[model samples]
Target: MISGETTLDVRRRLPGVPAHVGIIMDGNGRWAAMRGLPRIEGHRRGLEALRGTVRAAIDFGLDYLTVYSFSMENWNRPIEEVADLMGLLKRFIRNDLGELHKSGVKVKVIGGRTDLKPDIRALLDEAEDLTRSNTRLTLIVAFNYGSRQEIAAAARALAEEVAAGRLKPSEINETLLSQRLDTAGVPDPDLIIRTSGEKRLSNFLMWQAAYSEFVFLPMHWPDFDRHAFETALAEFSARERRFGRVTAQGQNGKTKKI
Candidate 1:
């Protein structure tokens, strides 16, 4: 967590803060292996880090925070490991849902749910329904989510519309395709932070992150704290985003589009 010293810094206020931030929470297994502990322990610690991250986001006054919780490909892992992950997800929601709701944090789950067990699907629905009206921050849990799958599903939906003569192929623009995705209505992430030093999207927010700035931290997910979040934001604040255009300094020393 950020110390009291930096918590009140005026520089950390709005205007520069990212309105939406996405996180690729990685390195839990590796962290556990390094410490000669089971992977489950690492995942457990990662949950604690998640709580810290949520608090940090609230402290920073962020509007949205999305996390890569469980990827669809994770189902290919050993049965035991998969079971452990499922157990942890259930535990986290059952134990922490009330706290999140009381803090005015809304929960949104993104990904396909057709194959999920009845109980798990119900729990996910309950989480979203319970905190749908929260205002402080929106926490998106990308469970069973893979960017490629998400994009493909959107394309398939558009194709079906075209096939049914409900929409024309020429009308399938970027905006339309984005609206079909699960993240519709939510703004594209302004900054994406990936922990554990690995560089790559790893199938996270491929289409939505077209212009997002990335910050890679060497610390593992279980070690992510408020200070780490602050460091990423600091890096983000230093970079200039041009979004496919050039920014030139004008005669009056003001930034102007070229």
Candidate 2:
């Protein structure tokens, strides 16, 4: 939670605000270990941070916010920890779905759902169906998602099309591949923020984040709040995003192709 004074200092519609932002929430276990608390407690606190961050995103007038909630690799963790995570996911949807819907936050779950338990899949489906009409903020949850797997799946689908003579081998391109991914209609993220001071994507949105600006924060996920979110956005505002091209200022006030 952010203090009232800090909230007042942060502008709602600040300049250079990214239309779409992605986050990699990390360090739940470490935060708990540092305090001699159970890992589950840190995870519970992290959930609270997530709730605050979502509200912050809405207040900031963002169109899309993607969170790396759970990855395919996460299943490698201990059984108890994994179960705890699943429990938290269920709790989040059950407890917060109504509020999210009322606030015009549409939930979109990406990644594989075929392998998830039937009940879990049902909850995810319910969240998306109920809030499909929302327009204020699209909260993308990357559950059981792996960027390599997503890319491979896209390629496999395209290959099958070519094999069936429905598409030519030469017709396959970046746009077509992007359309085949789980985030087909969504635009790529403009900024990616990671908590816990970690400096990696961890197989999250590799293809879509080709040009996204990254802001790494030293604070753990449980400590993230509205103030932290605003701080990250402030950093993003200071960055000069030129994609792959050179800016006129970089070329001594003369525009030229690199």
Candidate 3:
């Protein structure tokens, strides 16, 4: 916990709260190993943490929350573990879908769907469809997602358009590429939090998180709670986002252009 004095200091210099936050949920396996338990138990606890996080995000008045649930590279893990993870995913959706919908959270899953099993695809579709109208919060699940693949796919889409003469090479820009990505409708994350002391993104959102503020927590995903989130937000509030420009305060309190 931050000291009261420090909290007050951060509060005074605080910037605006983030409208969208992304999380790289990490360390379930490590957490389980430390406790002499199976990795699946850690994942189950992580789900509980996710539930609390959704409620906390709503309570904090956040608009969007993105979580890295499963990555494309994760398929390289042991077959048994992979199967367990998939089972947990199915169970989570089956058991918690109704409650999530009732809480007014719009579920959006972003990633490649071509290789996913039919049943998994159907479950994802149902989750999105059921909560399509909810507006309280948008929960983005990055399952079977990899930033490089997403970028490559987007580029291929743009190339196809150019080949078809629907778009010129000169007309292809950042905006066009972004529109082709899976996260086309979603705004870029303002803050990204990673648990388990990992400092890297691991290809979570390479393009979208171009300038997002990052908070790396020492605890694992299963241990993340509202207090941890508040701490990250407080740390973020203290930051001065210049966005490549100089602040007036840095110019002897005089307004200046970069």
Candidate 4:
């Protein structure tokens, strides 16, 4: 928890809330391990984390919140665990879609859908359709997402475009490649936060997060409360986003830009 802070103070302290924030939710299995519970149970508790994240992001005035729900490599986990995760995802869609829709949270699953069960796919479609036009907030779930896979898919798309003579090979610039990504229309994340002390990207949003400010927290994903989110936002607000150029406030506001 932030020390000696009021809600009003926190709200007043924002230089500017980011338009987009990405999260790599880590340590669910470890969290469960610590409690002597099954890894799947850890993922269940992680859903609680998801609930907090959704509401907190909305409260923080973020336009988009993208969560790395499941990576492509996660398929290597035990089949029972995978089944449990899929089951939980299905349940969330069934039980929470109405509430999410009512709150104007647009749910989008951005990744390969080929390997998912038909029922899960149907739930995703239903959730997306129900909240398609929601403007309050957009929540993107990167299930079975891999940055390399995304890049490969983009390359394939480009190849097809070139083969059809719709685009010149030389015309495939950065923007063209970005447009082919799963997050095509969405703005790149201004801040990427990973909870439970991990420092690696673990193959999340590789191409899009070239300049994103990163925050790593020691708290487990299930333990990430609103205060943890506020702390992250506070940390972000303190930094000068110079992109590549040095800013007048330097990066952390302690040193002056020369």
> Clashes in each model (backbone N, CA, C under 3 Å)?
0, 0, 0, 0
TM-score of 1: 0.95
Clashes of 1: 0
The per-residue C-alpha lDDT of model 4 at residue 115 equals 82
lDDT at position 204, candidate 1 = 96
- Score every model by TM-score: 0.95, 0.92, 0.92, 0.90
In angstroms, how far off is 179's CA in candidate 1?
A: 0.5
Global CA lDDT of candidate 4, please?
Answer: 0.90
Per-residue C-alpha lDDT of model 3 across residues 80-167, encoded as one tens digit per residue: 9999999999999999999999988999999989899999999999999999999988999999999999999999999999999999
* Predicted structure 3: lDDT: 0.92
Q: List the residue pairs that clash in candidate 4.
A: none
Per-residue lDDT of model 1, residues 1-258, tens digit only: 356655524434656799899999999999899999999999999999999999889889788999999999999989999999999999999999999999999999999899999999999999999999998899999999999999999999999999999999999999999999999999999999999999999899999999999999999999999999999998898898889999998999999876
Alpha-carbon error at 255 in model 2, in Å? 8.7
Global lDDT scores for all candidate models: 0.94, 0.94, 0.92, 0.90
RMSD of 4: 4.6
Where model 3 places Cα greater than 4 Å from the true spot, the runs are 1-15, 250-258
Per-residue lDDT of 135 in model 3? 92
Better of 3 and 4 by lDDT: 3
Worst 10 residues of 4 by lDDT: 6-15
Candidate 4 local Cα displacement, residue 120, angstroms: 1.1
Over the stretch 65-158, how does candidate 4's per-residue lDDT look in tens digits?
9999999999999999989988899888888899899988999889999888788788889999999999878999999899999999999999
